[model samples]
Target chain A: MTDELRSRMVELLPRLRRFAVALTGDLDQGDDLVQETCMRALSRVDQWQPGTRLDSWMYRIAQNLWLDRMRAKKVRGVQVDVEAAEALAGPNGRRVVESRLTLDAVGAAMAYLPEDQRVLISLVCIDGLSYKEAAEVTQTPIGTVMSRLARARRELHARLEGHTREAIPRQQAPKPGRNT
Target chain B: MSDTPDEKTPAQPIGDDLIMPYADGVLAPDQRPAVREALARDPELMQRFEGFLFTRGPLARAFDAVLAAPIPERLLEAVRGPTPQRTRPTVSLLGSVRLARLAEMFRVPDFSPAVAVPAVLVGLAAGWLAHYAIGIAVPVDSRGVVDTASLQRALEVTPTGGSAKIARGLSLAPRFTFATDQQVWCRQYALIYGDGLEAGGMACRAPDGVWQVLMSTPPVPGVRAQGPRPAGEGPGGNTPPNNENVLDGVRSLFKQGDVLGREKEADVIKDRWKTP
Candidate 1:
């Protein structure tokens, strides 16, 4: 192929890293994910049939890697409320310091999701892959993909709503120090 | 709302397939209104979708950070092989290595202003000499005029293939002529001399306008040939023994007024010899 693929890698690296961060939820782990992705890409250079979308191929590789790591760990981590994180993150870090704080919060929230949900969310929501492309990467049926997506959405909604409810005053609860 | 402690909304609930795509703004424009309507009625649902999108943005940013992280020095050194002793270093690492080396080179034992000045001067002289030598050895000009006088003027000289039409004196009179050795001529200032089947000589023109031979090969081969000898040898004065003999014959002929030389000189003097 032309230097196009190699040059495209430089442009893709940051985006790939973002995918990795979403997948792994820790900066260092995300870096490892990126490294693994690059190394795998290099070693299996032959598998990449040219003319196909490179970003999709790379996202698949990252998601696959995340899945493999989770399977090996066999430890399920608690999923964070994405809305709670966004309320703190505020879209993106337009201001340098604010951005980093937001990034950290986002990272924490991403780490909170179950591995499958996190991967699917990053692929479809973050990287903007279509369900068909995500199915192709995840090696699942489109229907199964849809079902996992539904469960992930409901779970995220409950977690966010729960945090919002906890933040505001509840009519049922009285002041702890005062006797009614 | 009271009966649904464990029940979800009956609307099949927007799956990640729909919600995620909607969050990315990748949903078809016509389909966005439907999703927006769903979001409007459900604050909890809207919040979840926003969270999905906002977290996605930072996750993307973190990836950039990882990629932008400075690569370790060891990795760079590994990429560019170690420099061998006594061989010139190929600092193929980053573009910054050369500047570092230059800074290091500037530091010397007992470094002084006097030492540095003389060292720089000697380096310049050596560089000029090397360049001059290479230029003479392989002069690369292709536009040099094919004339004995112009050849003499050239710092480097080579042979041209066609007829050598050398302009002489002030009126640019045509003088001696010869077919070329090769099909190339150059205008570059370099000493180009070659003698094989044809014995070439480097000719330098004197201040007095007479062409003098700086170097030449003998006309007679080492082994004496039995028949007829050569064209410029015994009886018929067609070609001279070498370029020197040609110049000498031309000068003598000018002195004797047998061929035009002084007439050309007089015109040159009149045209160019202004006192002030």
Candidate 2:
């Protein structure tokens, strides 16, 4: 990797880690996502332009990696190591458990949203992407991004308030729901 | 979280629906003056506005720990391996400024107490702690009891003297902090001057991260209650008024040196609220 690319990657680990956590729901998966994104970025160096928003590119990669992981998870049972998550949490596992409760409430709330809404929020709401940048990353219209974001926020508010109930899942799914 | 609306102009009356746009920063610049004006006088609307702000930040706060965590060795090796083998520069992944900003994002849950503090308490209403039939600064439910939610919110999130006019327009001042026998952090505070009520209490952060009001008393009557004694007071007020009746039947706990400075208390709170 070039020196400039290496420096930017270092600078973006925090942002990338943040996006991964939001996308993957916890730090264990988030770590995998960041690692995968970095590996992909470094291996396919020519795919990125020098002066572009490298953070957004990395975010898109992490999102794509997370999506791929969710697909693969369908073949096998969902496995999130409880002890590993706790260990990752250090003295506190906000990154691993993320929620004060047994699971991550923000992720649980985000699971109530459609994929597009989740992507919109991960981009614009948490990652500080502009409307245009979010639209570009998600490849959606700006108006759609804005409206979907509103709906997502509204649904999230409701779910967070326990006003919305998650559909009982027959089998494990990636979308956040009652784990047990 | 910033509760105040646009600072460009004062608040003006506006529809509740306008709160999202204002909070999302998409509100038209010209339209902000009226919305800003409205959010000021309307505590209810102001709270709703703050709710919108809270929604925007939960994801960040939820995963904030990742920002501070050392990257997995696999990822670091992945980066180092790709580059020509040179000594890697020890660049802090997140600068101190960014780290502090990330830490600052942890806010007490707004709008949803149950969602915010999900462990060990169901909304932590503390209906059982309603024995103190004393005057209160914050409004009370029908039982004439002070609900712990509003007071706990003030204790958990708002810094000393920095509360917005929330829930009953009461001005709460965090007086001191200590750890319970269970190692749960607790804070002592005064109701100060709100709704003609003068009271003080200790709130401990239960394992679930909710501040449980341990004791609520209206300061000793005739013994001359000591005001908040910061470090300079020399611990003269260490002994809470030596009046039995003032204890209000609530056991007085916490030894001296138990209380801490407002800044230290905030640090403990941040630690208690640490991610995971």
Candidate 3:
């Protein structure tokens, strides 16, 4: 790896860990995301220019790696039961158990959001980035980013309020309700 | 968890841009009125909206844990691996310095109530104790109790001419003396030794008529003249009240000395031994 690449990796680790935590909702998974991002960034040394944001570049790599993992799992016929997935994540709650319950509920709500919503929520909500910057990172138009974020907020609110009825298997909902 | 509403209401027109900035308290000053107006219109939306706002305070509380996460030494070592082999000396030195400063600015302290409280408390206590050490004690019964004997006995009084030496090296002792004229004594002590110690010392009467430091020698020294006390650097440095050592002394007084299990006797003596 180039010296620049090595320095950049060192600089990005803390933020990478944060993003990973926000993405996977697990410390170990977050670390893995960071490690994978580092490995990919190092291996594809030519794509990184010196002047652009090293943080953003590495985040792009991480997002791609995380998305690829999700795609691979789907391809392997493993569906993501988001509710079940949420039950398994951590860094929950706040002050006492009460605080923690609040955190977990929020986490679960965020986790069950659609993939695009989840990514943008992680970017703008958990990481406190500006909407414009989040748009650039997600590689979507600003308006699309706003719409997705708005929808994400709605979904998170629904989930936290316990309005997310158990995920009814697709065939169970009225057949005509599939008008997406 | 069950207390939450069963059905999620259709969300109001709160936009991500508006909600996010509002939650962060980053909205421009003029725009707050519009957001507040919108929030007032919907109760359910307001609750969800407040959830995000309330979460930030707790999240800021929890953010300290991020820094506290002990990165296993082995993991850090693995991450830092073979540093000698990949030496890149060509990076501009100025850029590294700027980055280092930025990192230092954002670096979080170790989390935990014990660590955080003590870090601040020790410094504050140190200031107060240092002041109390050389500073004279004043016995004032601000409430007009006139119980000079109890105050003198609490200090294990020794006759020193017109005044009495309540135990010397009292770092944590309140500024007021246990006497009927406590307010007078506290004012006298403050006037004499208030310099180099806690500022604005005043005497007061406790609920039980015992006189005590209204703002007992704060645990920390005053902001001015606050530099280098270990080697006795400041004005109060020469006679810095060693609370740590004196606290140990107090502990020893009960452990090896004759202060424990003699509460009534002490109180009796405290009430009888008046200053000359």
User: How much TM-score does chain B earn in each model?
Assistant: 0.26, 0.39, 0.28
RMSD, one per candidate, in order: 27.6, 19.6, 22.5
Rank by DockQ, highest first. Answer: 2, 1, 3
lDDT string, candidate 3, B101-162, tens digits: 32342233432222222222212132332342211122322222222222322333311111
Worst 10 contiguous positions by lDDT, candidate 1 chain B: B85-94
lDDT of 1 by residue, B173-227 (tens): 1222221112111111112222212222333222222233322322222121222
**What DockQ does candidate 3 have relative to the true complex?**
0.07
Candidate 1: segments with Cα more than 4 A from true spot: A1-8, A75-101, A150-162, A165-180, B1-23, B28-276
Model 3 docking category: incorrect
Best TM-score among the predictions, by candidate number: 3
Stronger candidate by DockQ (1 vs 3) = 1
TM-score of each: 0.41, 0.45, 0.48
Better of 1 and 2 by lDDT: 2
True contacts kept of 2: 0.38
Candidate 1 iRMS, in Å? 17.5
Model 3 chain B: lowest-lDDT 10 consecutive positions = B183-192
Error of 1 at A108 (Å): 2.1
